[model samples]
Target: KPNSELKLQIFIDTSSLEIFINDGEAVFTERFYFDNAPQVWLTAKAQCLTQVYRLDGQAITFE
Candidate 1:
């Protein structure tokens, strides 16, 4: 489908990347390691709206 709306979800962590397209209609995953922090960029031919969300996690120590 061309020139149609699509829902994309991308989850990125320290060592992994996950992408879900169209509410799980398609998916992609990869593992990567970098010596320094990575940069992200977005580009599109047509105008669109974008949203970003940040998630936090709690840590536990083992006895």
Candidate 2:
């Protein structure tokens, strides 16, 4: 991305992931299931800022 900031969002729920880039300009959907992957890595060619968040699903119990 040149002359513009790049934005990305990742949502992980039940062994599935939905990724968004540049507010839906580009997106990637993937499903991965492994009890142990040991090492996970990311490579970025461009200089950027990254953030990670863990999602909580239906934390509140309903009666």
> For candidate 1, which ten residues in a row score worst on lDDT?
33-42
1-63 per-residue lDDT for model 1 (tens digits): 889987888888778888899999999999977668666677887887889877776889999
User: What are the runs in model 1 whose C-alpha is more than 4 Å off?
Assistant: none
TM per prediction? 0.81, 0.55
For each candidate in the order shown, give its overall lDDT on alpha carbons: 0.83, 0.71
For model 2, the stretches where C-alpha displacement exceeds 4 angstroms are 36-51, 59-63
What digit string (tens of lDDT, one per residue) describes model 2 on residues 1-63?
456776878776667777789789999998876576323355667687767665466778789
Model 1 clashing residue pairs (backbone):
none
lDDT of 2: 0.71
Q: For residue 40, what is the lDDT in candidate 1? A: 61
